[model samples]
Target: MAKINKRRKRIFNMLKSHPQGLNGEAISQQLGVSSRTIRSDIKALQDALGQYNIRIFSSPTKGYRFSQFEHLSSIEHELFKDNMSNLETSKQRINYILYKLLANTLNDISITQNDLAEEMYISLSTLKIHLNEVKNILKKYDLRVTQYKTKGIKISGEETKLRYCIVDIKNIHLENEFFQDLIMNIDTDLLDDIIKKVLSERKLQLTDRSQKKLCMYIAIAMQRSRNNKTVVYPSSLTNKIENTFEYNVAKEIIENIYNQLNVDLSCSEVYYITQCLLASKKLIDVSESINKKRVKNLVNIILKEIHEKLSIDFTNDEYLIDGLTLHLNIALTRIQFQMNIRNELLETIKNDYPLAFQMGVIAGKIVEQYDNIKINENEIGYIALHFGAALSRNGIKENIQAKNIIIVCSSGLGISVLLKAKVEEYFHNRLNVVKVLPGYEVNEKTLENIDYILSTVPLKNIASDKIIKINRMLQKEDVENIENKIFHKKDTDLMEITTFFN
Candidate 1:
């Protein structure tokens, strides 16, 4: 099981309060995290709940709720189980060691075996065991760990590969004590204020998650610079970056950091930091500088591959072409700078849109061919979102059943029958009106296969969510409202991408 965090607990508590439940946006409001994070947390919580005879029920309309409230106490305990003990787990320790090694390498700090063991609260023998696991992880990234009796241990690899490995470490280990320690050492609030001020002054807006990531990249860069591990940007790239507004803004941000932290960074370090800033923020138009022939060929090949392999044609999608070209150009910039591109919606995109993700993988292969840089799953997910949006625009529909609705009316058979027919005429295959019954006749057993109840009369004992009151003769506005509910609804299982492959 994944480590349960405070956000997940708060989310569960909030959902527990509203048995009728809350949507992603509503839950996001109650908790200050983004909807994306809430969606991710919901999936993790769902997986964790299965063992407790509890389940997180979700739908486009209902958001999420626990299936069995009787198991709440047990579920809560399980979420908090092994809280302090989690750090001692072999997998957690391995992640911690990997994070320490990568972060120290970037900061050019060597860690002695004894110090490492002490930091991990493990004996030398146990530390060695975890070190072996760390080595295997490093090997996957084509990196090697070097240890010496005098100098301790450090990781070494190609510069770009090293950055990529650090990105991987950050993704896996950000919640651990090691990363928390790194954050605690810096005045992150001051850094955040300055970053916001600078971005506002420059009129460059980033989403909450993007802004958070930008601050993290800056913090990492600052930590490395403090340890005398300076970044050296290639001269060609440096010259190009120096001419951009992003580079200037990076300089300003660095200057603010120096003022706040009393640290000086080398010009190359500034240039490198500038690239990191640009990586997480919106891309400035590089249409004039991008290779038109290369991007055009890449798009044509991607569309062709999707057409031949999946029988999906998007040849006439000029808007797709324009949008994709811009995205590819930005992607190339990130590759050139060896910057990590994170897509928080990656899991959702992959889960909800399998064919789009497959097409994205094919496109990613073409991207890999054009540039030697291997695209990560996160980047591929972003590409998939583009294709998914394109598919939605072109009216390519998925035959997903929205719900199994039970209709209830207090009126006689004629009125109930008319209501059912109206609903069926409107919703069609999107929903199944499984049963029609008088309101007084309805009970818990009748709701067995039902997603929810559509009632002409108000339900007394039934949960608010179990019955949705509607007119016997539905108005045009009611039809539109139901249409919105059926069409724009997101699947409750936010982790549909992983589910698809599994």
Candidate 2:
């Protein structure tokens, strides 16, 4: 049970990041394993981690995550953190190649296959094999590898897609931690200030994340502009947004950028920047569309459907409705225009906020059915945030049923009283510390009708699921184990609680 493979170690970290949970197919895809292999790995993980109170929770479709507990200390952190960071796997190499190609494309640089293979310390044949996987991934972003074998390889895609793919790769591979420095020769600090000032003037409000993303997009724009890789918007696309408030804001932003960098940005950039603003989860839209009624209806339908599917009524949640309405309306425009904004936290949301992410997935399907357009995971992650917030706001408390428990403390009465106090304080009304008994008094007559026996010391011949052997001080693992065993979420309310002691 103590033994674990490197793959399972990666699985542990992946599950940690994705508290929502991941399905077998998803986990298998990330780890490059089969569903059968994943099943065995999960079983092994459950057995290995059970000692540490790291319970693996798995719903039929919601996926797998650490059940209720958030922290899992990796056993190999000191031994493998350094080795883990290096590009050891084929997946890592593919990611490296993707980044190199995109980075080169961003700066209009080129490198031959020979040099690329040499730099990575991989053979030409191995690099070629990895390139096949790299090409498949790029195809999803509407990007292609170009000029191979002759003038060296470059990423051939729309300017916006290039930027999107650059961010997308970082999210797909957690080890790709260097995307923040993708901006070069530009003062992002000054750019941030300018964006804030322009946004204030326009009375536009953005989340901190949105603002940061805009800064990066604008920086890329500046760098790309200098390289003559300017994005061009079609007349039809330009016509739709050219006169909007966001357009005006984007125009003001570029004007400030020009003043800061002394480089003239193309007219298309104004629309490009506006698209970024529209694609994000904004606090205020520059202009509210006349189709606001339709968006409200969609939000209502989504909440109603979620209630039906999850049996949680969010129809009366005005905050959730309003948030979804605004988000979906912009999402419609984003999908229609193919804006493809990056969601940095999609994997985390999908794994960690499993229920909410499933809700988002459900909501996304409804929108897809309505608009006849497919929504990506990034968009669904944004939708999940709304549901996740609603879940938190309305969750109020864990639905706990009162349980009968006897604290079998071999220590003195004071120590037993202290353990009882800790149990009462931590668990509140969830558990009943019926009586504190010495080890001698823990036999059948006292154990009769006792739902659980919490002991500081080991108890012999008592191997029931209800037996909780805890630390003397009730450490985190002890608390977690007790919680997992006794604190069940039932449909009953606090008012309906009936304790054995009472």
Candidate 3:
């Protein structure tokens, strides 16, 4: 028997459990050590394991996992028992439960609820609540939870829906608070980097959130493919997606991931990834989409339907038009592929914003009528979130005293268009953006009637308090600055916003 260093023992345990591997970033976070120190430790551990057949393989993408293993369990007592992070939040626990149940189903294995609860370090009573939440989420994908006498609970569904369910669940990512456990047993960072680079090269667009989601799907698809489980689309549907741009993008992404992870996904995986892209909230120029007659007509119909049904007028609201045009195009793809996500915020939206939800239902029905397909509660809830924003915008117009504002951007055209739109859309007549001027163009007359000069760079000779510096892309704090400094929105009326639609 050889004496092992304390740090090397812990690293060995993490490598043993994480079959897929962890990047230096993830491993360092888990171990509370510097990446430089981790690199040294991995080297020392590799030398120690040389006598055994175990070898550590590193990839630029996947970090490190064992490349070879034999009789490694013989040294198990020399290492710490477990390196998995404890499930703390309800978010983390439910995500963990979903992964275990789904992974077990794919592997054709079963364990009792007692066994699972023990494995997760949770009480059986507590597990029931988490399991119930998981069951409700599964229902959205036509997946049902099944219990067995000896084997614990398992998800029962079509192969395709099961994979979609996994994809829809964004693995519990708690940043610095979590380690080795939150990723549903796989590192998504590698996949995310692969997908991000692919999309950038191809010039396709996805929001940051959507890109993370696509990575989640790819990670799950790769794991399941390893388990010999795969998504099967109808040949006609598959053929249709195969010819699309998203399919080409998926092919490239998967090829890159294959090179990194050494996992060759079934061809159907490519088509499924294409469907994920279509169902994703695609970011595109509103001006470009509004010209499409179908999207324009659909937006018009949705706006008219909401107005007629709710007596709220938004027919000419360009923000709403832009929002719906972008959303409905993706909704149409989601509907086509039957890709539905259980919106975690759906219940909150319905309870807190009834009128907004009603508007969403109305909008959903219009989409259904336009395409002759039913929109699920999940989709309706998403539509409602946007409607809720519009309602809030409409409500605040009356209460908040409108302020004149100027935006100063150097070269002001491209970036200012987006910033100006975001400010106008969010403030919605509360802060009137009087003009966008370059720093060189900021004269006294340009500053007249302007309450705040929202600028990317500080203008010389301008009063510091009067000029609010903002990112080229409007960020959370930038919005907060405008809200607190310009509008004094915290002191603004709350009554109209809560009671207006009622």
Q: Model 3: per-residue lDDT, tens digit, 168-246?
A: 5534433423222324555577777788778778867564446667777777777777778887678888876776668
After superposition, the stretches of candidate 2 with alpha carbons farther than 4 Å from their true spots are: 1-96, 106-110, 119-121, 147-149, 167-182, 284-286, 306-312, 344-355, 391-502
Q: Candidate 1: deviation at residue 176, Å?
A: 3.0
Q: Which pairs clash in the backbone of model 2? A: 18-351, 18-352, 19-351, 19-352, 20-351, 20-352, 20-353, 20-354, 21-351
Ranked by lDDT, the better of candidates 1 and 2 is 2
Using lDDT as the measure, the top candidate is 2
Model 3 RMSD in Å is: 14.2
Q: List, residue by residue over 340-385, the lDDT tens digit for candidate 2.
A: 7666557876776799899999999998898789998888877887
Per-residue CA lDDT of model 1 for 1-502, tens digit only, reads 7545556767878888988878889988877778887888888778777777788888999888778786687657656653334564788788777777876775577989887775454679999988988899889778998975587998987655675566556756666665565544777788888887887677655544456666776766666666666665667888878766678788888888788778677787678766766565342243233576788778988888888888999878885776677667767777666676645556765676787789889889878876677998977876776676576555423325658888765432223444565676567567777766545446777777677788767766767555667875566776765654555434444456567885
In angstroms, how far off is 212's CA in candidate 3?
A: 1.0
Instruction: Provide TM-scores for the models.
Output: 0.55, 0.56, 0.58
Candidate 2 weakest lDDT stretch, 10 residues? 76-85
